[model samples]
Target chain A: MKEQLYGLITGILFGFLLQRAQVVRYDKQLGALRLCDMTIVKFMPSTILVGMLGVYLLLDLGLAKLSIKATVRKNMGSGLNIQQGRFSLQSQP
Target chain B: MKTILDKGWSPYLAGALSGIILILSVWFTGKYFGASTTFVRSAGLIEKMLNAPRISKMDYFVKKVPKIDWQWMFVVGILIGAVLASASSRIFRWKALPDMWEARFGHSRVKRGMVAFIGGVVAIFGARLAGG
Candidate 1:
């Protein structure tokens, strides 16, 4: 129950941010695809780096325990929960 | 009436705020904020309801959607939120199409629509192939 509330709060915060970023805008998404504006690219690495640092710090301090992510299951009955096949991480690949 | 939410916030600030929210979601719930998948699901349900064969056979379509309908509730929420925001921001320029799109496809509305439809299919299919 607590975890679900945590998730809802996070969703609200995230949604608000999405509204602000204009990322919700199709133009920015297309712009990133077109390479006309690299702001999104710049933001991606920063966000990942920040998250990684927080994770590493938590590990070092023994404040948070991390678990291996569940491996992508082959037959999850429905494809909904399954990882949508793997492919290159490159943009416009 | 149309002039409500006119002030645009700084994009950088907005981007940072977005990043913070995304990071928080990951930290708390272990999920990323993604609406495209929801869109994929909604489109699937709609096609299923209409009995569209093209939607059923494509591996790309099948993989991204849920078996049950109404799985796209979040997408509905997004649309509602956007509508509210537009109404609030006084930026609610309700056009059937945006001007930038006209620049891309010229005045042939049907051509533009077909191009958009086909482009979306290719984009999602290509993403599935390359992402997998």
Candidate 2:
């Protein structure tokens, strides 16, 4: 119950942020994808950096531990790689 | 209402806020931001209701059981939040088609709907294929 509540709060915050950033707007997304607007791109790196730094900090403080689940590894290894390869091939002229 | 609904926050400010929220979410819940899985789960749920046995046998469904989890609730929150934001912004207007769609497609509802449907299907299919 507590966890679900936490999820709900965070989800609302996330959604608010997305809306404020105009990411929910189709025009904004299309502009970002086409490289016409860099607003979304500017935000992406910051999120990645913050998340990465937080994880490392937690790990260093012994607050968090890493567990590489077998299924996740397998899915990434077979599913993601094959999909990437196919997409790259298709994108070529 | 006029003051609050006039304009949006600056992009940089919004981005900074998003970054902070992302960090907080990770720190508190230990989950990354994502909504694609919710869509998959939704599809799985409908399939389950129609043909439980067949859906259960599928490998994807086996791995990703369709239950209302945190991510699903998150998506619901997203919908609610979007509606709230739009309402506050005074930009909440009802239209079957948006200006951009009508401008590009010349006011053809069928064409617009078809294109949007196809785009959504392709996006979901690609997201699943990429293991998103």
Candidate 3:
């Protein structure tokens, strides 16, 4: 219960920041994809830098343990199967 | 200081705050921020309602174990927060087609919906394959 509540609060802050940054806007996303806008590019790097620093600091201090999910791929052929789409549930490695 | 009533904020400021939120999220919960998995779990939850046996047999479902966990609540919170933020900024409105999309792609609701749906599917599929 406590953990769930914390998740909610954290998501709220995240959503708030996303909105305030205007990266959630359709134009901003489209522009970023088209390589015509630097808003998302700028926002993401700053976030990544800070997040990396903070997370590393915590890890170095032994306050948090890193949990990395391994990449798994299964049942995928060498060639792309358009009919099956790029991703398949059966594909895991 | 930008108030809540402001339409938008500096990306740098918002990004910094988001990073702090990310840090705090990890420090307190020992978890990282991710939104895509919530969607996959949601699909699993819905599928479980319709096909319980199939869900059990699926490899991904077995590993993920779809449930309304903390991340799910976090996603719900994200929606609520977005609504609150937009309302506070007095920019909340109902529109099936946004102005920018319409201006670029024209006002064909069907076209817009179809494209958006396809895009969403592709994005979600990629996100899922990449494990969110």
Candidate 4:
């Protein structure tokens, strides 16, 4: 219940930010895809930097747990091997 | 209100705000932001509803259970937030084909819809394959 509330708040904030940044517009997205607009490029990196710093800080403070798992699947007949990995970090209650 | 709606926040300011929000999200939830997984889960849900037994057997569907998680709520929030923002800005308008699409591909609703649908399908598939 508490976690869902937190998620709701964060999601609202994220959506508001996206709208304010004008990236919700199809043209903005298309322009970014075509390399004609720098809005998304700028917005993404800044968000990544802030998120990374915050996550690391939380980890340092022992407020979060980082779990990483990797799986390797091999196709016997095709001789193809595929590796898939998922990394998740969750806040400690 | 009209003038305000016509103009948007400065890119730098918006970017900074988004960064701050991202930081806050991680600080509170310890989860990264993404919409792809929500899409995958939504597809799984539809498939489950259609044929539960078959969907349940699929590894992908089994691993990513069709449940309304935080990310799903996040997507809902996004839609509501967008509507709120548009309403506040008074720039909310409905149009099937945006100016850019019309200008680039001409005013063909069918064409626009088809292209968008195909693009969305490809993007979702790619995201799933990449395990994003």
Candidate 5:
């Protein structure tokens, strides 16, 4: 239930940002596909950079822990690779 | 207030806000924010309504049970937020066709709809294939 509520609020903020960025606009999408505009190009990288910085900062501050899955899952067919992060609940002292 | 009421925001601003949201999502849920899988789960849910046995028989469905889960509600929230954003910006409207599409495709609703549907299918297929 708590997770669901978090998902809802997070999605709302995401959707609002998408619309405000105008990436949801048909013109923007088509333009990006045609390589005629850089709206998405600008938006995506900025988002990713900020997200990365924020996440890493949280990690550095011991506010968040990295949950790394195994490199291979036979049932899932694909897996994530976490190269260096501590993939456990233990916090840095 | 003016920025909020504007039809559009600078991509940087919106993108940064999105990043913050992503941070929050990860911090709280220990999961990256993504919507592609939501659509896949929704298809499973819809299919489940019609044919429960077939759904159960499917290996993928067995792994990913179709139900109204967190992601589903997240999608619902997305719809609501989109509506709110459009409404707040005073850009909300009901139109069968977008002006850009009409101009390029000459207002053929059928063509637009078909192309859009196909695009959606291809996009989702790619997203799922890449394990969104």
Candidate 6:
């Protein structure tokens, strides 16, 4: 019961934020692709920086437990075949 | 030199709000919110429904995309918010201004949309296949 309530509240808040930030706008997205306006690009580095710090803090406090863990960045090509393996970690030889 | 950003909230506000969305999507859906992935999944579903033989052959189209169709309501909220912001700021006019696309490849909104769609498909497929 507690988990469900947490989810509902969290989803609503997230949705509200996405809408407010213009992240959901087609033009802003397309603009990012074209590099006409890179607010989104600027937004990412800072977002990641903050996220890294927050995650560090959480981990240090033993509060943030990530489930289904894997760290990788995929430079997928498109919608047809969803590829995510461009960059990955491998067992050291 | 005021810009669109000058009119919007501070970066701290935007970033914090976005972080909240990220945290919540993970908590509630057991999934991270990524709009592009869904777009690819949607295309695959459409192609399947149409029995397009080529779709299944593609490296990216074979796998199923995640779902939350009703989640579209969340998207609607986003649209409403953007509209409200633009209107209130009196920046509601659609600017058909020349963009990098127009400069590089000439103008055609249809073409641009198609490129974006194709790009989206390839991007999602690559990311997933690559284990992203």
User: In terms of lDDT, which candidate is strongest?
Assistant: 3
lDDT of 6 by residue, B25-112 (tens): 5444544434444455566777777876777686766554333343333444445555666665555667443465677878788887
Model 4 regions more than 4 Å off: A66-93, B1-5
Model 2 pairs whose backbones collide: none
- The regions of model 5 sitting more than 4 angstroms off are A61-93, B1-7
Give DockQ for candidates 1 onward, in order: 0.16, 0.38, 0.55, 0.39, 0.47, 0.18
User: What C-alpha lDDT, on a 0 to 100 scale, does residue A15 get in candidate 2?
Assistant: 75
lDDT of 6 at B122: 89
- Each prediction's Cα RMSD? 9.6, 6.5, 8.6, 8.9, 7.7, 8.6
* Candidate 3, residue B92: how far the Cα is off, in Å: 1.3
Residues A1-93, candidate 3, lDDT per residue (tens digit)? 888899899888888788878888888898999999889998998899999999999999998887665543332442346436646645755
- Which digits, one per residue and each the tens of the lDDT, describe model 4 over residues A1-93? 666677677778777777877888898898999999888887777777766777778789988655332322324323332222112222323
**Candidate 6: segments with Cα more than 4 A from true spot:** A1-38, A53-64, A67-93, B1-7, B24-31, B44-66, B69-81, B94-98, B103-105
Summing lDDT over every window of 10 consecutive residues in candidate 3 chain B, give the lowest-scoring window.
B1-10
What local lDDT does model 4 show for residue B1? 65
Model 2 lDDT, full chain set: 0.76
In model 3, which runs have C-alpha deviations exceeding 4 angstroms? A72-93, B1-7
Clashing pairs in 1: A85-B132, A86-B131, A86-B132, A87-B130, A87-B131, A87-B132, B4-B90, B5-B88, B5-B89, B5-B90
TM-score of the second chain for every model = 0.64, 0.91, 0.90, 0.91, 0.89, 0.55
Pairs in steric clash, model 3? A72-A93, A73-A92, A73-A93, A74-A91, A74-A92, A74-A93
Model 4 lDDT per residue over B48-124, tens place? 88899998898978888988888788888888787787777777889999998888789889998899999999998
lDDT of 1 by residue, B37-98 (tens): 55566667777888878887889786765442222343454455555555556555656555
Where is model 4 chain B poorest over a 10-residue stretch in terms of lDDT?
B2-11
Error of 1 at B120 (Å): 0.9
* Model 2 chain A: lowest-lDDT 10 consecutive positions: A62-71
Among the numbered candidates, top DockQ falls to 3
Please provide TM-scores, in order, for all candidate models, with all chains considered together: 0.57, 0.80, 0.85, 0.82, 0.82, 0.53
- What would you estimate as the lDDT of candidate 3? 0.84
